[model samples]
Target: MNLLSKFATVGGATLVSRIFGFVREMLMASALGIGPVADAFNLAFRFPNLFRRFFAEGAMNSAFVPLFSKALEEKGEAAARDFATQVFSFLTVVLFALTVPAIIFMPFLVRTVIAPGLNVCIDEAALQQALSCEDRFGITVAFSRIMFPYLASMSLVAMVGGILNAYRRFFAAAAAPALLNVVLIGVLVWALWDGQDTRALGFAMSWGVLVAGVAQFVMVTVAMRMAGFSVALRRPRWTPDLKRLLVLAGPAALIGGITQINLFVGQAIASFKPGAVSILTYADRPYQLPLGMVGVAIGVVLLPELSRALKGGRLDEAQHTQNRSLEFALFLTLPAAVALFIIPEPIIRIIYERGAFTPSTTAAVAAVLGIYALGLPAFVMIRVFTPGYFAREDTRRPMMVTMASAGANTVLSVALFYVMAEQGIALATSLAGWLNALLLFHGLYSRNLWIVDRSLVKRCCLLLLCAALMGGVLLLLMPLLSHWIQPGAGIGVQVLAIGILVAAAVASYFALCFVTGAADRQMISRMLAARRKRGARNA
Candidate 1:
C-alpha cells in the first residue's frame, strides 16, 4: 500500500476508536463528574494507562516494529514468527512478574508515587464532611488494583499489534482500542441501568477496563494468527535475539519511563487540588482525538515504513516518507489545535456539561483545553520526528532529550500549579511538549536525517495560515452561536450547534487551504480516484 493509503487505513480506524473514546469519556463525565468519585476514577485509570504507555506503546513497539519489520524483510515469515514468539514469551513472563507486584503494592504506590497528595489529611473533619479525601484515596487504591492487569493485556496487544503493522495489517490493530471503549460504554450503560452507587460504579468501570484489555488482546492476537503469525506462548529463555531485543528495549523503556513520569508528575501535582485531576482529564480528551488520529497513526505507519526503506537502501524514499508524514501530520493537526484553542468552551459544554457536570466545571475544563491546544501541534510533531530516530535504532538521544523534557515538565508543573491551578499544570505540559518537539526536530536536522524540502516548508506555512484564518472565523462566529451552546440548552440543540461550529471551521480551513494552494484540489481528486480504482481491483 502507498503511504497515504496505509495512513488512511490506520487513521480511519483510529478516528473510530477516538470517537468511541469520546463517548466513553462523555459517559464518564455524566456518571462521575468532578467529585471525589470522578477524581478517584481518573487517578485509578491513569495508573494502568501510565504503565501501558511505558511498556506497550512506547518501549515495546518502538523497539519491536523496526526490528520485526527488518526480520520480515531479510529473513522470512518463519523467522519473523519465531522472533515474535520469543519476544512474546519473554514479554509475558516479564509483564506477569510486574503486574502481580504492582497489584499487591497498589495502595503503597497510590500513596507515594501516583498521588501522594491523596495521603494528606490536614483538616480531616472538613474533608470527611465534604469530599471525603480519605474515602477517595481508599477507593482509588481499590480501583487501581482492579485495573492494573490491563497493563499486561495491553502490552501483549501492543506486541501483537507491532507484528501486524509490520505485515501491513493496520486496521485490526488500530481498531482494537475501540473495543475497549465499546466494552466500557456497555458497562457504563449497564451500571447506570442498575442504579449502582458511585463506589460500585467505579468498581464496574475498573473491571470493564480489565475486560476491554483482554478483548483487545484477543482481537489482535486472532488477527495476527490469521495473518499467519501465531505467537504460541513458551517458557522464557535468554536467547541472543531476546538479548538484542532487551538491549534496544532498555533505553526505549527509559524514554517511555521518562515520558510517563512527566505525566505522573502533572497528574500528581493536579491531584493536590480538589478536582484538578478530573478537570485536566476532561480537557485532555478532545485534544487526544486529533493526537491519536494524526500523531499515533503517523508514528505507527512511519516506523515500519522507514525501517523497510532503510533496509532496502532506499534513502530517498525514507526521506520523502518522513517529509510527507510531517506535512500530513501538520495539515491535519494545525487546524485541530486552532479550533480547540478558539472554541474550547462551546465544545466542552456540548460534550460534557450535563448530569453532574456543571457550567463551572465546563469553564474550568475549557480553560485547560485551551492551554493543551497550544501544545497540540508540538505533540503531533514529536510523533513525526521521533520516528526518524527510532527508525535509525537510536533511542538513547530521544531518551536523553526526554529526560530534559520530563525535568522541565516536573519543575514547571509544580511551580505553575500553585500559580495557575489546573491550567498551570496543563500549560506546563504544553511547554514541555514544545521543548521535546524542538529537541527531536533538532536531533533529526543536525544529523541530516530529516531535512525539510521547500515544498513541505511552504505547505506547512499554508497550513498555519489556514489554521489562523479558521481560528479567526471561529472567534467571529462563537459569540453569535453562544446561546445555542449554553449549558441550559437542550442536548440536541447543543449538539447541533457544536456540530455546525465544527463543520464551519473545517469547511473554512479546507477552503482557505485550497485558495492558498496549500492543498491542491486536483491532487486530492486524483489521489481519491486512484484509491477507488485500487479498491475496485482488490474487490
Candidate 2:
C-alpha cells in the first residue's frame, strides 16, 4: 500500500470511529455536561483504556510482533500459529480472572484511584452562573463498576490485534475499533432520547463500552477465523516466547506508555473538582485525534515492517523506515498540535458547545486542551520512537527509560497538581513527555542505534516550515469557519465549516510541501495516483 493509502486504511477507519466518538461525546455533553456523571463516566472509561494501552496496545505489540514475526519467518506459519494460539488462550484465562475482581471492586477502584476531592461544589452561585447544574458524585462508584469488564475484553482485542499485525492483517484490525464507537453512539443516542440526568448518560455510555469491547473482540476473532488462523486452546506455557514478552513489556507498560498514565494523573488530580474529570476527558479527545492517527498509526504499521526488515538482515532498510516514519509523524502531527494550541476556543465550541455545556465550561475545557496540546507532538513521538527498541526485542532498555520517566511524571504530577490545578497536571505530563523522549534518544545515541539522516533532517526542517505556512492559513480561516458554524447552526453547516477548514489546511500544507520539496508530498502524490489507478482497475 502507498503511504496515504496505508494512512487512509488505518486513519480512515479511525476517523470514522472518532467522528462517531464525537457524536457520542456530543450526546454525552448535551446529557451530562461536564459534571459528576461526566466525571464518573470519564474516570470509569479511563481505567480500562489506561490498562488497555499499557498491557494490550503498545506493550503487547512492542513485545509480541517482533518475536512472532521471527517465528513466522524461521519456522513458518504453523509455528507462528501455535505460538499465537497459546498466547491467546492464556491471555483469555488471565484477563477474565483479573476482570472478575475488577468488576467486583469497581467501587473501591473509584475511591482509590480518584483521590478524594472537594466532594461537593460548595459554590452554588458558581453553579447557577455557569448553568442550573447539580453535583452528582454518587454515579462514579456504580457506573465505574458497570464498565470495568471492558478492560478484560479490550485487552484480549489488543492481543488479537497484535496477532493480526504479525500476519499483516491490518484492515480488520484497524476497523475493529470503529465498532466500539458505533456502540457508544447507539447507547448515547438512546440515552439522549430518554433525558439529561447524569446516571442516565453515565450508565448508557459505560455499558456501551462494555458491550462494544465484547463486540470488538468477537469481530477480530471472526476475522481471524475467516483468514484461516484458527486459534486453539493451549495451557499458559510461560515459554521462552512468553518469558521474553513479559520481560520486554513490563516497564513499557509504565514509562514508555506514560501518556496513558497521564490520564490517571489528570483524573486523580481532577477528582478534587466535582466536574474536573469530565473536563479533562472532553479536552483530551482532540489531543487523542492526532496522537492516535499519527503516532499510533506509525507505531502499529512500522513495527511489523521493521520486525520483518531487521529479521531478514535488512538493517539499513529498518533504520530508513524508522526515520521515514518519524518524518511522517512530525509532518502530520505538528499542525494538529499548533491548531489546538492556537484556537482551542473555536475547536471546543465547534465540537462540544451545546445545550447544557456553556461558554464558561468551554473556556475551562479549552484551557486544558491548550495545555494538553503542548504535549501533542511529543505524545505522538512516543509511539513512533518506542517501537525502535521493541522491534529489536530489546525491551529492558525501554523499561528502564519508562520507569525513570514514570517516576518523573508521578512526582511532577503530584507536586504540580497542588500547584497548578488541571493545567498543572497537563503541564506535568508535557514535561514528562519531553523527558521520556530525551531519555529514549539518549539511549539510542549511547548505543549508536539510529540517528536522523541528513536528508531526513533537511526534510524535517521543511515539514516545520510547511506546517507554519498551514498554521497561517488556519489562523486566517478558523474564525470565519467558526462563525459560519455557530451553536445554533445546523449539522450541515457545521460539517461544511469543518470540511472547508480541513480541506484548506491540508491543501495549503501540500502546496507548501511542493514549494519546499518536502519528503511526504512525493510519497503522498504517489499514493493518490496509486489510489486512482486502483479505482480505475476495480471499475
Candidate 3:
C-alpha cells in the first residue's frame, strides 16, 4: 500500500478505537475523577502501560522486525518461521520467569517508585488550592498488588504481537490495544452496577488488563494461524537467534526506556503535587490520539519496509519512502498539533468535566493538554525519523539521542515545576519531545543517513504555511466563539464547538495545500485507491 493509504487503514481503525477509548476514559473520569481513587487507578493502570510502551512499542519491535524481515527476504517463509520459533521460546521463558519475581517484589517496588506520590507534594498554602482528595495508601497498595502481575500477560502479548507484525500481519497487533479499553469499560460498568467504590473498581481494571492481554494474544494467535504461523510451544532454546534478538533488543530497550524513564521523572516530580499524576494522565488523552493514529502506525509499519529496502541496497527507494512518510505525517499531524494546542479546553470540558472533574480540574487539565500539544509535531517527527535508523538496524545511536533528550526532560521538568506549576511537567515533556526530534533529525542529516531531499523541504514549507493559516483562523474565530465554547459548559456545546474548530482547521489546511500544490490531487487519489484495495482485502 502507498503511505497515505497505509496510514488511513491503520489510522481509521485506530481512530475508531481511540473514540471508544475516549468513551472509556469519560466513564472513568466521571466515575473516578482525579481523586485519591482516580490517582490510585491511574497509578495501578500505568504500571503495566509504562512497561507496555517500553517493550511492545519500541524494544521488541526495533529488535525483531528488521532481523525477521531479513530472514524472510534471505531464506523465505520456512526460515523466518524457524527464527520466530527460537525467539518466541526464549522470550516466553524469560517473561514467565519475570512474572514470579514481579509478583513477589511488586509491593516494595510500588512503595519505592509510587509511594512518593500517595500524598500531596505541595506546601500548606498550595494545599488550600489543591483538589480535595483523601490520602489512601491502603487503597493504593491493595489495588497495586492486584494489578502488577498484569505485566506478565502484557509481556507475552508484546512478544507474540511482535512476531505477528513481523510476518506482515499488523491488523491483530494494531487492534490489540482496543481490547484493554474493552475490558476496562466492561469492568467499570460492572462496578458501577454493583455500587462499588472506585478502589475495588481499580482492582477490577487491573485484572481486566490481564484478561485483555489474554484476549489480545488469542486474537493475534488466530490471525497468525490464518497466515499459517503456529502456537505450538517448544522446549526453551538457547541459540544464535536468541542471542541476536537480545543484542538488538537491549539497545532498543535503552533507547525506548529513556522515554519511559522520563515519565518516571515526571511521576516522581508530579507526585509531590496532589492530583498531578492524574492531571498528566488527563492531558495525555488528546495527545495520544494523534500519536497513536499516525505516529505509531507509521513507526510500526515503516521499519520493516525500510529494513527490506536498505538490506537489499535500495538506498534510493529507502530515501524515497522516508520522504513520502514524512510528507504523509506532516500533512495530518501538524494540523492535529494546532487543534490540540488551541482547543484543549473544549475537549477537556466535553469529555472530562463531569462529576468529580470540576471546573478547576478542567482548567488544570486543559493547560497541561495545551502544553502537550506544543510537542505533538515533535512526537510525530520522532516516529517519522527514527525509523530511518531502525530500518538500517542501527539501535545504539537512538539511545545516545534519547539519553540527551531524557537529561533535558529531567532538568526542564524540575525547573518548570516551580516556575509554571505542576502542569509544567507536561510542558517539560513536550520540550523534551521536540529536543529529541531536533537531535535525531540533525544527527541523521549529519551522518548523511537522512538527506533533506527537495520534496521533503517543499512539503515542510507547505506544512508551515498551512499551520500559519490554520492558526490565524483559530485565533480569529476562537474569541468570537468563546461564549459558545466555554470550558465549563455542557458537553454538547463543547463537542460542537470543538468539532467546528477541527473542521475549520482541516478545511483550511486542505485548501492551502491545494493552492500551494504541496502535493497534487493525483497523490491523494493514489492513497484513496490504495485505501479501497485494502478495504476490499479486509472484506
Q: TM-scores, in order shown?
A: 0.96, 0.92, 0.94
- Best-fitting candidate, scored by TM-score: 1
Q: Can you give the lDDT of residue 134 in candidate 2? A: 32
Q: Pick the candidate with the highest lDDT.
A: 1
Q: What overall lDDT goes with each candidate model?
A: 0.85, 0.76, 0.77
- lDDT (10s digit) by residue, model 1, range 79-114: 888998899998988888999999898889999988
Q: Write the per-residue lDDT of candidate 2 for residues 387-440, one digit (tens) a residue.
A: 788877777787777777777878887787778777777888888888888888
Displacement of the residue 306 alpha carbon in candidate 3, Å: 0.3
- Model 1 CA lDDT for position 476: 89
Stretches > 4 Å off in candidate 2: 2-4, 118-138, 476-503
Q: Which pairs of residues collide in candidate 1?
A: none
Q: How accurate is candidate 1 locally (lDDT)?
A: 0.85
Shift in Å, residue 19, candidate 1: 1.1
Q: Looking at model 3, which ten-residue stretch has the lowest summed lDDT?
A: 124-133
RMSD to the hidden true structure, all candidates: 1.8, 3.0, 2.6
Candidate 3 backbone collisions, by pair: 121-272
